[model samples]
Target: MPNNKDLPVSPFSPLTIGPLTLRNRFIKSATNEGSAPGGVPSKRLVQFHESMAAGGTGMTTLAYCAVSPDGRTLPNQIVLDRDTQPHLRVLTDAVHRQGAAASAQITHGGCFTFLKPQQAPRPLSSSSGFNKVGLMSGMLRKQAMSEADIQQIADDFVRGARLAREAGFDAVELHMGHGYLLSQFVSPLYNKRRDQYGGNLENRLRFPSLVLRRVLDAVGKDLAVVCKYSITEGARGGHTAEDGAAIAQILEREGAHLLVLSAGMNVESITTMFGSSFPKENRVSSNNPIMAAAMFIQSLTAPKVDFRELYLLEHARKVRAAVKMPLAYLGGAKSLQSIEQVLGEGFDAVTMGRVLIAEPDYVNKLEAGTSRDSICTSCNRCVAMMYTPGGTSCVLGQPGDAQLNAQPAALI
Candidate 1:
């Protein structure tokens, strides 16, 4: 029912954040590429990002760059270290050549590390507890982080931001969402400790606040600092939409340059990431039938919601009203109409995952008046490839289809 002319602004318009200026409002959302191996960026990784940049995204975020070895989701996730700086620089240079800024989503996977015992000594979390998703998927061990360990992880975040700057990144987005270490501390579902790092709202937000403060102190003026955080965990006893708004206020007060609003945890709201239907075959480990059956039963009792355009706007609007800082709206942005609607609502920008995976040059096509909607179809098969040895690709697309193979992949 809405058109581009109904909007007062254009998604293609240039915008400024601190000292950096992006060419447009379309940000390539931080979808894991699954191309890095041994914490080093490979040629395939470089080429993949280059294609996104060349496709006309205002900025392309390199996803899941772990702040430390123990914090990684997988053994092969990119780690900020001396050995990987050169390769990161090359990736940044390649993005710049295609006229897009580069950003790194720095995070720690928490208890979600589904690696063998040989690969990781133990998974870390806000408190010691059984991780339902991890336990169901085969992760057998996790440990509560000590006070010293907490401080070390925060310090590691500062060091990661420094590496991002050295590698010529225009921005670094702190990953405080999707059941990661920071989000674990914030959620009541995970944090049951009586220490200063747990309990009430302020206590729960302590570690994440520390990390944000340290990162800002290290590179506040040098590069833009963005944080992608959940507004709601989408379960009882977890955070509500109101809690998310308060968290946004804290991030803005702590000097985050931008806030990318997201929601859902791995357990209850896994469907929040993938609209309509989740690819069960991609999510449940095929080797583990117990995990599959558990997921099936969970899906039956879970909430039923359809995947529609701009699905996250209602929740993101709460954060937008609570804080005056720039905000980037993500989730279910698959068409030119939806993007225009977001900008019209006063959101500073829009980010896309599945759509971009299916059509990397979607923005260019929209700008050229060649297309108004992406053909992605929201199958989310590309998301499955992240867990496999091969890199991410659209399941329906052919081999050598630019960067992401034409086959469908799952996203979570």
Candidate 2:
């Protein structure tokens, strides 16, 4: 058996997944940048990724590229289709010019789609279900996916992978977590079907497994294939850490080049996936009072956690033990020491989202020994702006930024 002790020792050490070799261990985790207008790459999106590439992330993920039209969380999200190839190539070329590898996160929104009626007739999911995100984002109807729908989605994922490869991306990360379409099928909380696609863990793993198979078949040898899966849904009757381990093994078995272990579902544990908090006072300005109240109540009732360094490390470790594939540790990694600690623990690499958002040149800073910690205080202000039309920016640095409305500061 391969030993964790035999892995790369330095955060700056080179690592290989499939045919791609990363300059370092710092990967920019996918955070939805609301910059793709009408599902096309905009200047803002290009700049957002180019800046990170220049800043020194080994690989910067262009977040949330939906496989199909109805599979978008945000209406303006990038879609991996024929028309997007040229734009995606531009985005990838920008990252490559900066001496960084580019990765695209491909997903299907399922019942979580935030499109208008004109955009799609209705949203889709593993089975007929209420659109939880719809309730929050203002749409509230979803149709259960037929077997044909499932097969088509798998094909779409394959096409998306092909598009990512043709676009010059070094890798593609499949978003099988956060209660998106794949996770919707994986989690019992969302998937309620009597067919072979639902019920037990093996049944639940069917659709996502098929999706992974198609993606690998499409571009397995040409580009590295990484999968980000939730370790726990954190909801009763949802997924547990053990289930996550099994899923990780399944992905590894299906030939995933790497596994990025993440946690939480959108409807069940939004705060868990995003380390943001929803204070009672902030709910006053919410367009959906009912959702705001529900979020507030959930926040009060859920486990209280102060954002700490390596928040998801413990749960991720369990997944690490279950699979031999290179695992990218994500969530709450801030300082150089924390990163070193994770490397020391035998995780293949560390993935950062908010840290890079705050300090784009974070990896360069660490290499230069210029700083030990990030400027972000886990304020989650950037997180708030991402949901709005203004796109993502640092609240402290970019004050009066019209996109992030005048909301009170995030709690540390």
Candidate 3:
């Protein structure tokens, strides 16, 4: 097995993300396990991050914190309203205690929120409507975003950032990619507006930039701001890697400290979040054994054409050349050697979702030079449905009652 004893240790350098200094470049990409409920952090969520930090991640980001109520894909997805701060403090404290910087990703679900109906449903692209994604029910109603509503949502991002800071988070990442609310506004497939918020590149990017400005004002330069933008949305007719770089440039000009590059928005129906369109074989936690064949068939014909959150090798290189700001990449990277290569290639950092979920100690294991197969099978079971009945819990990540203790963050 791979362990540090034999492998070359890529100098565990000190990396600065905004004002925070990380011991290493390994970051736990935000994975929503439904640990937080009602938009508040649960005890289980605290433990989840604590374990990841204790396992030695340089930094970790809180995934799926919705900026607006209607923008949620699952009811259990954390809501960052006035009521959420109380529960968030616990999780933030846990991350800090373990010596890892904590960042919160503020997202808006737009029309795909089957979780909870937002008090307001302002769709950026009324023509295409909200995207219907995997294991989700009901059609998302599409409504045009008024200038007034746009302004409000932008302001809401600032509000959410302020709350994240108050809860003691080290940084905040705006969820502008992945066909979410901001993504809908920026994507060519979703955004079809003629106003200042749409049209040319400048116009299409207006709202996102404005939101960043507001967040900066509310949080100040003392706070590190990050934006996770799409490199190339999995589906066609969406923004490309080139467009992703332009968005990065916009965020940098707006004073963002970092940009996280992600790809394949709303491609979960065919591929898993890790971008694995199909697995090599049926394993415990991957796409169900029975349904797995269909995905394998799809992969043979259209692996690169369709979105797969798998390895980011194909797109990260393109993005690295386009912008100057520090870039972090997220897809489904599981190989330690591959991760080292990704950073060596130009990505400032690398993130893992299910890989980390399957092994929260992934960073520490890599540091110690341990070669162990992840328990997760790339099944996408956790994401098959928004949130399991109550909050969220990964059956594969948190196997049986024994795994439950290791996954306390699911209590909410």
Candidate 4:
């Protein structure tokens, strides 16, 4: 257990992040809720975030809001656009009513998508290569992004941020981590380009930096612009801890309001990011059999990492020393003790996913001193729930709960 002594600030303290101020330092990190159907936020999705707000989180993030239609990792993922702004507004308003700020995580899947050619012909990525995840959907390969593709995606990020502001989001978290489009560009393991956008750290960062600058220019005044990126890609030849710190410094220079420091890649080193081995029972709930099979096969060889409290603290501290911008630590924070320890370590805030999913009101319990630790066992069943018809939920909760059993939305 972390000694809670000599902490500079409590997790309950308010934090200012550029244009927005959180009521407390605890933020519910982005977790794809799989509730959006037809690329629009559903009523359940609104209620999902509302629960987090009411439970006492300073802010709750709507996860994986793709910047463009073709950018979605799944057909049902929400897309931030004119057509969905009203639905998103409803979500943000609900969070505001509970006195918690709302954040939209704007992202592009890049080559990580499962869309077929008929749906997303020529899916673009940093460099063209065989796409293992896309193989199940017949999207066997990805196209190396051309100059026009790069500019168009950057424009899409601007539009997404603009729409997020229109939707009443207090912030827009640009997802540059988790082996997504931006992450692909940053990792040498994925980016093998010989053009100006490749070959070195500065070149790899060029595209993501462009996207961040464009979004900040468009909505930095209206909403806090948070950039979440991996501090380490967690693979042998991928971005290292030093590269992560350099990325943080560059982002600070680029004017990101806050940095959410994370690690690992969804494609190459997911367990390293989450600090847990893949659960064997994870195959039962997927709506897509092909994806289920892929996950199962991957699990067989997925690197095993024992779950530990504050898993990313060491790497995050390096980033903290490299940049003066406010930093949010994400990964393995499950208790008030851990949260306090992270804050004491100089992080401006702590972002949690599994604990929040396990108990939406966990923060409230901590503030009241009613609970010192979360009941989450880190079984990772909730991770599997992300692909379920009902979206992510704690298996420890009662089965067949209506909110956890919402009818599956038809895939676009």
Best by lDDT: 4
- Which residue segments of model 1 deviate by more than 4 Å? 1-7, 116-121, 136-141, 280-305, 400-412
Clashing pairs in 4: none
Query: RMSD in Å for candidate 3, one decimal?
Result: 5.9
Question: Which residue runs of candidate 2 sit more than 4 Å off their true CA positions?
Answer: 1-8, 116-121, 137-141, 279-304, 387-390, 399-412
Query: TM-score of every model?
Result: 0.89, 0.89, 0.82, 0.94
Model 3 over residues 146-180: C-alpha lDDT tens digits? 77878878887888898889888888988887667
Best by TM-score: 4
Candidate 1 residue 286 Cα shift, in angstroms, is 7.6
Model 3 backbone overlap count: 20
lDDT of 2 by residue, 125-193 (tens): 887756776656666767778888889889989988898899899999999898888988898888899
Question: Tens digit of lDDT per residue, candidate 4, span 1-412?
Answer: 7656554888898999998999999999998886876776776787789999999999999999998888888888888877887778878888999999999999999888876533446778899878766756677788898898899889999999998999899999999898899988998988999999998988999999999999988999889999999999888899888899999989999999999988998777878888888777787766677658767776876877789999888888899899889999998999788888898888999999989899999999999989989999888878777766666788998432345335322122
lDDT tens digits by residue: candidate 1, 214-280: 9988998888889998888877788988999999988888888898888887666776755556556
Q: Give the root-mean-square deviation of each candidate in angstroms.
A: 5.0, 5.3, 5.9, 3.5
Ranking by lDDT: 4, 1, 2, 3
Worst 10 residues of 1 by lDDT: 403-412
Q: Distance (Å) between predicted and true CA of 229, model 3? A: 1.6
TM-score of 4: 0.94
Residue 269's lDDT within candidate 4 is 85
Residue 263 C-alpha lDDT in model 1: 89
